[model samples]
Target: MYETFYGLNGKPFSLSPDPNFYFASRGHQRVLSYLRYGIHQGEGFVVVTGEIGAGKTTLIKTLVNELSGDTDFVIGQIASTQLEASDLAESVALAFGVSNEGLSRSQIFNRLQGYLTQRRLEGKRALLIVDEAQNMPYSTLEELRMLTNHQVGDRQMLQACLVGQGELRARLQEKRMEQLRQRAVAFCHLGPMSQEETQGYIKHRLQRVGWKGRPELHQDALDSIYSETQGIPRRINTLADRIFLVAYLEEKEMVDRDLVTEVARELAEEQPSASDESEAALAGTQKMVSGQGEELMEQRLSAVEERMGSLEKLMDCRSLAKALIQSLQRT
Candidate 1:
C-alpha cells in the first residue's frame, strides 16, 4: 500500500526470500563463498545451518541464480519435512523429476541412482539441495548419505547440500553421524547481521526496489530498529516495513526515532512475547475472579436490604395494632 507513496517499484521488505534482494552482508558473503567452494569441489555434502529467518535459503537462492546459466550443473531442491528413510528417498526422486509412483523403497533408490547416473553421462553434475533438513530423522539423514555413495567410475554422480537450522549442526556432531560428517566438504553457520550491516541491509533492499530516499530513514530511527529487531534480517524487514507504512499513513517524509519507537511498541503489543502473553492471561483471569467476587457481594447486600425492609414493615404493623388497642381500652 505504501509503495506508490514512497516512490518504490515493489515491496522492499517482503517476508519471502528473493535472490534479487540478497544483501552481501559479511556473514552472508562468507557463507556464499563456502557454498561456492563446496560446489566447486563437486563430490560431497555442503552443510549450511542458521537460525530461523537467518537467510540461509536466500543465500542458496542467490547461488542458484548465479549458476542458472551453467549447463554443467543439474540442481534439484526440496524443503524437507519430518520424513522417514523411505520417504526421504521418494522426496529426493520427486525433486529431480523422477517419477516414483507405485515404486517400492529399493525401486525409488534405483530410479534416483539411475537419474543421477544419466545426468553424469550427459556431462552434468547433479546437485541435490535439501532445505529444512533438520526435520529428517537419523535414518533419513543416513539415507541422504547413502545417496552420495552412488558412483560412476571414480567420480561420484551426485553432490548434496544440506541446509537447515542450527540444530542440524548439533545433530551432525553426534557419534552416529560420523560417516556423514566425514563426507562434508564444507560446513558453515550463518549468524545474524551486525548493527552496521543491519542498516546497510535495509538501505540495500530499499535501493533495489527503486528507493531514492524520499522517505528518509534517520540514523536514530535505524538505531531504534536495530534495537527492536537485534540485527536479524527477517525481523528488520518486518519492522522496517511497518515503519514505512506508519510514515506513509502519517504523511511524513522523515522517519525519526520517535516514529520508529512508536511503531516498534505497536508491533510488540500486536505480537506479544511469551512472557507478555502469560502476564496478560494472568491479569485476565484475576479480573474475572474479582468480577465474580463483586457480583457475589452485590447479591448478598441485596438480600440483607430486603430482610431489613421486611423487618421495618413488621414493626410498624405491630405499633399500629398496639395504638388501636390502647384507644379501645380508653374508650
Candidate 2:
C-alpha cells in the first residue's frame, strides 16, 4: 500500500519466509555452515533448533534454493502438523513420492526403501527436512529413525534433518528420545540478531527490494526497534513495516526517534493491559475451580461407560460362542 509513497519496488518487511529476503546474522551463518557440513557428511541426522521467528525456516529455505541445481541430490521438505506415527509415515512417503495411499505400514516402508534405493543407484542422495519438528510425536520420530535405517551396502540411503523451535532440543534431551539424539551428526541453534546486526538486517532487506533511502531512518529509531524486539528479525520486520506505513501516511522524509516512540507506544497499547491480563487469569482460575467438580464427575461417568462397553462386548462374544456350540450339537 505504501510502496509508491516510499518510492520502493515492493514491501521490504513482508512476514513471509522468502529466501530472497533472508539475512544471515552471525548465528545463522554458523547454522548454515552446520547444515552444509551435514549434507556433505551424508549419513546421519542434522538438527537445528531456534526460538519462534528466529528465521531457521528461512535459513533452510535459502540453503535449499542455493543447493537446487544438482541432479545428484533429492531434497524432500515437509512441515510437521501434530501427526501420528502412521500419518507421519504417510507424509514422508508422499513427500518422496512413494505412492503410499491406502497402503499398509510395511508396504509404505517398502515403497520408501525402493525410492531411496533408486535414488542412490542413480548416484543421488536423499534428504528429508522436517520443519516444526517439535510437534512430532515420539512414535513418529521413532518411525523417522527407522526410515533413516534404510541403507545400500553399508552406506545410508536416506538422510534426515529436523528443524524446530527451542523446545525441540528439550524434547530430544529426554531419555525416551536418546536413540534419535544419538544419531544426530550435526546440531545448531539459531539465536536473535545483535543490535548492530538488527540494524544491518533492516537495511539488507530494504536494499533487496530497490530501497533508495528516501525516508532516512535515524539511529535512535533503530535503537528503539532493537529495544522493543530484542533484536529478533521477524519482530523488527513487523514493527518497521508499521513505522514505514506511518511515515508514508504522514509524508515524512525522515524517521525520527519521536515517531518511533509514538509508534511503539501505539503498538504497546494494542497489547493487552496488565489489568486485563490479571482479570483474565482470575477468571481462568475461577472457572477451573468451578468446573473441577463437574469435570471429576464426568470422568467417573466416562469410566463407568467404558467399563460397561467392554462388559457388553464380552457378553456378546460369549453369547456368540455359546450359540455356535449349541448349533453344532444340534446338527
Candidate 3:
C-alpha cells in the first residue's frame, strides 16, 4: 500500500523469504560460506540452526539463487513438521520428484536410492535441504544419515543440509545423535544482526526495491527500531512495514524516533503478553464492580429523595388545616 507513496517498486519489508532482498549480515555470510563449502564437498551433511526469523531461509534462498545456473547440482527442499521416521523417507522421495505412491518403507528407500544413483550417473550431485528440521525425530535423522551411505567409491551420491531452530543444535549434541553429528561436514549457528548490521540491512532492502530516499529514515528512528526489535531481521521487517504504513497514512516524508516508538507501542498492544492480558482482565473486572456500586448508590439516593418530598407535602397540608380552624374560632 505504501510502495507508491514511498516511491518504491515493491514492498521492502515483506516477510516472505525472497532471495532478491537477502542482506549479507555477518552471521548469514558465515553460514552461507559454510553452505558453499558443503556443496563443494558433495558429501555428508551441512547443519545450520538459528532463532525463529533469524533469516535462515533467506540465506538458503540466496544460495539457491546463486546456484540457479549450475547444471551440476540438483537441489530439493522440504520443510519438516514433526515428521516420523517412516514418513520422512517418503517425504524426501516426494521432495526430489520421485513417485513413492503405494510403496512400503523399504520400497520408498529403494526408489530414493535408485533416484540418487541415477543423478550420480548423470554427473550431477543431488542435495536435499531439510528446513525446520528441528521438528524431525531422532529416528528420522538417523534415516537421513543412512541415506548418506549410498556412495560410489569415495564420492557420495547425495548431500544433505539441515536447517532449523537452535534446538536442533541441542538435539545434535545428544548421545543418540552421535552418528548424524559425525556426518556433518559444516555446522554453523546463525545469530541476530548487530545494531549496525540491522541499519545496513534495512537500507539494503529498501535500495533493493528502488528506494530513492523519498521517505527518509532518521538515524534516531533506526536506533529506536533496533532497540525495539532487538536486531532480529524478521522482527525488524514487521515493525518497519508497519512504520511505513503509518507514515503513508499520516502523509509524512520523514520517519522520526517518536513515530517509530509510537508504532512499536501499538504493535506491542496488539499482541500483549500473557501477564499483560491477565492484568488487563483484572482491571476490567474492578471497573465493572465499581460501576455497579455507583449505580446502586444512585438508586438508593433517589428513593430517599422521593420519601422526603412526600413528607414535606404532608406537613404543609397539616399546617394549613390548623390555620383554618383557628381563623373560624376567632370569627
Candidate 4:
C-alpha cells in the first residue's frame, strides 16, 4: 500500500521467499557452498538446519534458480508439516511427478527408482529436497535412506537434501537414524545475519524493488532495527515494512531512530493492552446496567468508528489490531 507513496516498484519486504530477492550473507554463503558440494558429488545427502524464518527456504529457492538452467540436473522440492511415513513417501512421489494414487509404498518406491534410473541414464542427476523435514517420521527418513541405495555403477542414481529447523539435527542423532547419519555427506546450520549484514540486507531488498531512497534510513534507525529484530531476516522485513507505512502516513522523507522506536512501541501495543481489557470489562458492565442495549451499542460503535477513522492514515500492525478488536467488540 505504501509502495506508490515511497516510489517503490513493488513490495520490497514481503514475507514470501523470493529467489530474485535472495541476500547472500556470510551464513548463507557457507550453506550455499555446502549445497554446491553435495550437488556436484551426486551422492550422499546434504542436511541444512536453521531456526524458524532463518531464510532456509529462500536459500533453497535461490539454489534451484541457479541450477535451473543446467540440463543435467533435476531438482524436486517438497515442503511438509508433521507428515506420516506413508504420507511422506506419497509426497516425494508426487513431487517427482510420479502418480502415487492408490499405490502401495513398494509400488511408489518402484516408480521413483525407475524415474531416477531413467534420468541417470539420460546423463542427468536428480536431487530431492525435503523442506520442514524435521516433521518427517523416523520410518519415512529410513525409507529415504533406503532410496539412496539406488546406484548406477559408481554413482548414486538419486541424491537427497534435507532442509529443516534445528530439531532435525537432534533427531538425526537418534539410534534409529544411525544409518541415515552415516550416509549424510555434509551438514550446515544457518544462523541469523550480523548487524552489518542486516543493514545491507534491508538495502538489498529495497534496491531489488527499485527503491531510490525517498525515505532515507539513519544509522541510529538501523541500529534500532537490528536491536529489535536481532538480525533475523523475517523480523527485519516485518518492522521495516511497518516503519515505511508510518513514514508515508506522516509525510516524512527521513526515518529517524525516534520514529523507529515509536513504531516499535505501537506494534507492541497491538496486543491486548491493559487499558483495552479494562474498557472491555467496562463495556460489559455498561451493557448489564443500562437496559437500553441498542443505545449503548450505538455509542460504543460510534466511538470505535471515530478511533478507527483517525487510524486510517497509518495502516500499520497496531492500527489493524485496534480495528480488529473494535470490530469484535461491535459484534
Candidate 5:
C-alpha cells in the first residue's frame, strides 16, 4: 500500500518469490552453482534442502531465470508431494505437455520417453524440478530414478532436481530409498544469514524496489527482525510488510525498535498455548443463540479457531487484528 505513497516501483516486502529481488548471498550462489552443474551434466538428481522459509523456491526461480533460453531447456516444475508410481507418471506426463488421458502408467512412461527423445533431438534439455519433495513416497522417487535411466551413452535423456526443506533430506536417509539417495550427484543446504548479512539483505530489498537511498528502518528494528525471523526471507517479508503498513498509517518516516517489539509481542501472544482453551472458556461463553441476533459471529469465530491448526497460523491472524485495534487506540 505504501509503494505509491513512498514512490517505489513495487512492494519491497512482497511475499511472492521474485527473482529480481534475489539477494545472492554466499550460500545462495553456491547452491545455484551446484544446481547448474547437475543440469549441465544431466545428473539424475540434485537435492537442495534448506530450513523452512530459507528461499528454496526462490532459488529455483532464480536458477530458471539465469539459465539462458539458448539452452532450450523444458523445465517441469512440480510443487506436489510424492505420489504413487502411477500418479507420479501422470503428473510428469502433464508437466511435459504429454496427453495422459486414457493412458495407463506404462503408456504414460512411453509418452514421456518420446517427449524427452524429441527434445534431445532438438539439442534441448528436459529437466524436472520437484518442490517440497520431502513428502514424496519412496515409491514415487523410485519412479523418478527409473526415468533418469533413459540415457544415450554418457548423457541422460532427462534430468531431475529435488528442492525441499530439511525434512526431505532427513527422509532421504531412510534405508528403503538408499538407491535414490546414492544417485544424487550434488546436494546443498542454505542456512540463516549472519547479522551483518541481515542488514545488507534489508537494504538490498529497499534498493531493488527502487528506493534511491536507505529508508531509515531503525537499527533495533533490524535486530528484532533478524532475531524474530531468524534471517529467513519469508518471515522477514511478513514482519516488514506489517511494519510497512504501520509506518504508513501512523505517518512515521522510520520503523523503530519499539514498534517492532510491540508487533512481535502481539505475534507471540497470538500463538495459542495449552492454556488458550481454558482462557477462552474462562473468559465466558456466550448464551447459546440459534436464529439471528449474535449466533453468526460466534459460529464464525469458532470455525476460524478450528481451522487454525498451527501456532504460526493463529499468531498471524492475531497480529493483524491487534495492529488494527492499536491503530484505533492511538486515534
Candidate 6:
C-alpha cells in the first residue's frame, strides 16, 4: 500500500517466500550448503530445523526450482499438518503424478514404491521434501519410514528432507522411533541472522526488487532492529514493513527510532500487557484510544504526571497493541 510513496518497485517485506526476493544471510548460506550436500549425496533423512519464518521454506523453494528439470534427480515437496496416514499417501501420490481416483491404500503405496524403484534403477535419485513436519502424526511418520524400504536391490529408493520448526527435533527423538532417528544422514539447526547480517539482509532484499536509492535506515535504526528482532528476519521484516509505510506517507526518506518502536508495538502478535488495567486505568485507556495514532500523549509522560507508572501515560498502549493484533489476524 505504501510502495509508491516510498518510490520502490514492489513491497520489500512481504511474507511470501518469493525466490526473487530471497537474501542469503550467513546462516542461510550455511544451511543451503548443507542442503546441497545432503541432496547431492542422497542423504537418507536430511533435516532442516529453524524458528518460525526463518526462511526455511524460501531455501527449499529455491532448491526445488533449481533442481526441477534435472535428469539425474526428481524432487517433490509436501506440507504436512495434522494429516492421517491415508492423507499423507495422497499427498505423496499427487507429488509423484499418480491419480487418486478409486485407488486403494495398498495400490497407492505400490505405485509410489514402483515409481521410486524405477527412478533408482535408472540411475536417478528421488527426493521428498516435507514442510511443517512437526504437525505430522506418528502414524503418518511411520508410514513415511515404511517408504524407505523400497530399494533397487541395495540402494535406497528415495531420500527425504524434513523441514519444520524446532519441535520436529524432539518429535524425532521419541523412544519408539529411535530406529528412524538413526537414519538421518544430515541435520542442521537454522538460527537467526547475525547482527551485521541483519543489516545486509535488509539491503539484499531491497536491492533484489530494483531499490536504487540510498537505504533510508540509519545505523542506529538497524541496530535497534537487530536488538528488537534478535536477528530474526521475520520480526525484522514485520517492523520494517510498517515503518516503511509510516515514513513513506510522511515523505521522510529515513526511518527512525520512534517509528520503529511504534511499529513494533503495533505489530507484535501478543499484547504482553493486555491485562494490566484496573477500573480507573481501563476508563482512562478507553479515552486514550480515541486520541491514538494522531498524538502520542507525550504530555502525560512528564514523570511527574505519570503516577500510574509507564503502562498508561495516556499513550494508548492498548490501542497500539490492539492494532497489531487486528492487523496480524486480518493477515
lDDT of 1 by residue, 205-320 (tens): 99998999989889998888889888888998888999899899999999999999999889888876899889999999999999999999999999999999999999999999
Query: What shift in Å separates residue 206 of candidate 4 from its native position after superposition?
Result: 1.0
Model 3: per-residue lDDT, tens digit, 46-164?
99999999999999999988777899988889999988887877888998899988989899988988998888988999999999999998888997888777897667988999999
Residue lDDT tens for model 2, 86-150: 77667887887778778898887778788889889888999899999999999999988988987
lDDT of 4 by residue, 88-169 (tens): 6577778878887888878887887788888898999999999999988888888778778879877798789999999999
TM-score of each: 0.82, 0.84, 0.82, 0.79, 0.80, 0.79
Model 1: lowest-lDDT 10 consecutive positions: 80-89
Alpha-carbon deviation at 52 in model 3, angstroms: 0.7
lDDT of 4 at 192: 94
Give the per-residue lDDT of model 5 (tens digit) for 186-275. 878888777778778888998887876434678888998888888888888888877777777777787888888878777678778768
What are the lDDT scores of the predictions, listed in order? 0.92, 0.90, 0.92, 0.89, 0.82, 0.81
Q: After superposition, how far is residue 260 of candidate 6 from its true place, in Å?
A: 1.1
Worst 10 residues of 5 by lDDT: 284-293
**lDDT for residue 169 in candidate 2, whole number 0-100:** 97
Number of the top TM-score candidate: 2
Candidate 3 overall lDDT versus native: 0.92
Model 6: lDDT equals 0.81
Q: State the displacement of the C-alpha of residue 71, model 3, in Å, after optimal TM-score superposition.
A: 0.9
Cα lDDT tens digits, model 6, 1-331, are 6776655788889888887767778888888888889888775788899999898888888888778768888877788879798777778878877677788888887787778878888999989999999899998888788876567877888788999999998888889777678888878888998899998998888876677664467888888888889888788788788778777677777777777777777776544455554766888987788678335656646654666666674458888888999999999
lDDT of model 5 at position 79: 79
TM-score of decoy 2: 0.84
Query: Which residue runs of candidate 5 sit more than 4 Å off their true CA positions?
Result: 213-215, 274-331
Worst 10 residues of 3 by lDDT: 146-155
Query: Which residue ranges in model 3 land beyond 4 Å of their true spot?
Result: 276-331
